[model samples]
Target: MDNLVIAATERSPAVDFDFAAGVLSLKGESYPEDASTVFGPIFAALEGFLGVAECRALRFDFELIYFNSSSAKALMNMFQLMDKAAARGVTIEVNWFFAREDETMKEFGEDFSEDLEHVTFNLATTQN
Candidate 1:
């Protein structure tokens, strides 16, 4: 299947989901007025991909400088989807990248990974 890519806008992030490569990434800021509008397609595509990806290493990178509460919710949903896939025997690795100076985002990444037991999760700070 073809990959999913969305350019970054003032209010949203850039999404790069390469299903064939098993590497997916989200970058930039996300505070879209309607979070669902931005994540709905992502959720669908990921769900479809997860259904067929078996025993494969899938790395998901989150490199967001900032995001709103709604975006946070969307992020959590993405994590849940990943966790489910991991539980189903998929090798899912998640790397959360936040600005070095942003303590809040760093903490958010930690808090978000607390519930994911089946996936390998890492948090790293990116130099601004």
Candidate 2:
């Protein structure tokens, strides 16, 4: 399948999901006018890809500078999907990257990974 790429906008993040390579990354800020409208298709695409990915090294990178409450919910859902895929034998790695000075973002990342057991979750900080 073709890779899914969504360019970043002032109120949304960029999404780069490479199904064949098993690398899915979301970067930049995220506070879209409608969270579900922005993330629903992404969720669907990820679900479809993970369903047939088999045993593979899947990496999901979330490098968000800022996000709203609704976006937080969407992020949680994405993490849950990754966790489920990992539970089904996919070697999943999730890297949550926040600004070095953003303690709230770091805490958010921690909260999101709290229930993840099957997937390896890493809290990372971007360099100055």
Candidate 3:
């Protein structure tokens, strides 16, 4: 499958989804003008990829400097899907990278990690 790559904008993050390798990464800030529009295709592609994935190990890395509530909601939705895939026998790992100085981001990562039952979520600190 073709990889999905989206360049980051002033108000959005860069998305790199490699379907063949089962690796997906999102980096930079996200406060898009319209959060749903920005994340809609990403979710669609992820759903399509996961639908056909068979016991494959998937890794998702999220390195966000900041994001609004809307983006957070979209992220939660993505996490839910990932957990579902994991529950269905896919090996899933989520790495959430946050700046050392950003307590809010760290807390958000922790909160998000708590909701996953099957996916392995890790909170890693990045240098400032």
Worst 10 residues of 1 by lDDT: 42-51
- What TM-score fits each model? 0.97, 0.96, 0.98
Q: Which of the two, 2 or 3, has more lDDT?
A: 3
All candidates: CA RMSD in angstroms?
0.8, 0.9, 0.7
Better structure of 1 and 2 per lDDT: 1
Which of the two candidates, 2 or 3, achieves a greater TM-score against the reference? 3
Q: Which stretches of candidate 2 lie over 4 Å from their true place?
A: none
- Per-residue error (Å), model 1, residue 26: 0.3
Tens digits of lDDT, candidate 2, 1-128 = 77899999999889999988889999988888899999998888988888888788999999998999999998888888888889989999999998899998999989988989899999998995
Q: Give the TM-score comparing model 3 with the true structure, all chains together.
A: 0.98
- Give me the overall lDDT of model 1: 0.92
- The local distance difference test score of model 2 is 0.90
> Total backbone clashes of model 3?
0
lDDT-based ranking? 3, 1, 2
Best by lDDT: 3
Sorted on TM-score, best first, the list reads: 3, 1, 2
